[model samples]
Target: MSAPDTNTETQHPAHKTPLAGIAIGVGVAVALLIALMVWLAYNGNEPRDASDGAAAVQIETPTGGSLTITGTASD
Candidate 1:
């Protein structure tokens, strides 16, 4: 005659996920980046250099003349 089987040691513990914390961290980082970008965009519209002092030159030969423009360098 066999005795009845009993298992008393099996156990599974509850786990806490770190995904919530990670999600919040990432969200805060994205928000800060967006804020920085917005600030830069808002303040970046001011012209750094003054164009009021720009000058053009003109040259003349015996039969022809030429004009040289100063501030029109194209990349």
Candidate 2:
């Protein structure tokens, strides 16, 4: 009896994974987050000057006690 011939050609092509694209996207996101964090860190530590037009409020309670608060109006 004769042996059957085996097929040497592939039926389907191999599909490539988008590893490089995913890596680049992750890198960009991380860089943007780091930059935002750095910007916030620098801006948040700035000192507020008293000459910057700060406002104060005082409230008198029914028992003749007073509450004093001071800061900018936006605070």
Candidate 3:
């Protein structure tokens, strides 16, 4: 006489998909974009060179005064 079956049956594939490549690509792109934005923001926020000081701001005094710009670049 034969014994009853005890093994289980599976309907789907056993191995799961690994989309690490796509994830890595997206991460790299995001990092690059963030770095670029940071670079642009830093450059935009500060003056071009040590010679150029703070940005020119419009000001109207009680009797109107001439603007004198100065730069104190330590390093």
lDDT of 1 by residue, 1-75 (tens): 864754434322212246666888999999999999999998985445547654445666677867565553331
What's the CA RMSD for each of the models? 12.8, 10.5, 9.4
Q: Write the per-residue lDDT of candidate 2 for residues 28-67, one digit (tens) a residue.
A: 9999999999999888954566566776678999999999
Candidate 3, which segments miss by more than 4 Å at Cα? 1-18, 45-75
- Pitting candidate 1 against candidate 3, the one with the higher lDDT is 1
Output candidate 2 Cα RMSD.
10.5
Instruction: Show where candidate 1 strays beyond 4 Å.
Output: 1-17, 48-75
Predict model 1's lDDT versus the native: 0.64
What would the per-residue lDDT of candidate 3 be over residues 1-75, giving only the tens digit for each residue?
764763435412332234566788899999999999999987785566445554444556678875654535442
- From the highest lDDT down, the ranking of the candidates is 2, 1, 3
Pull out the clashing pairs in model 1. none
What are the Cα lDDT values of the candidates? 0.64, 0.74, 0.63
Arrange candidates, best TM-score first. 2, 1, 3
Identify the runs in model 2 with alpha carbons over 4 angstroms from their true place. Answer: 1-17, 45-75
TM-scores of the candidates in the order shown:
0.41, 0.43, 0.39
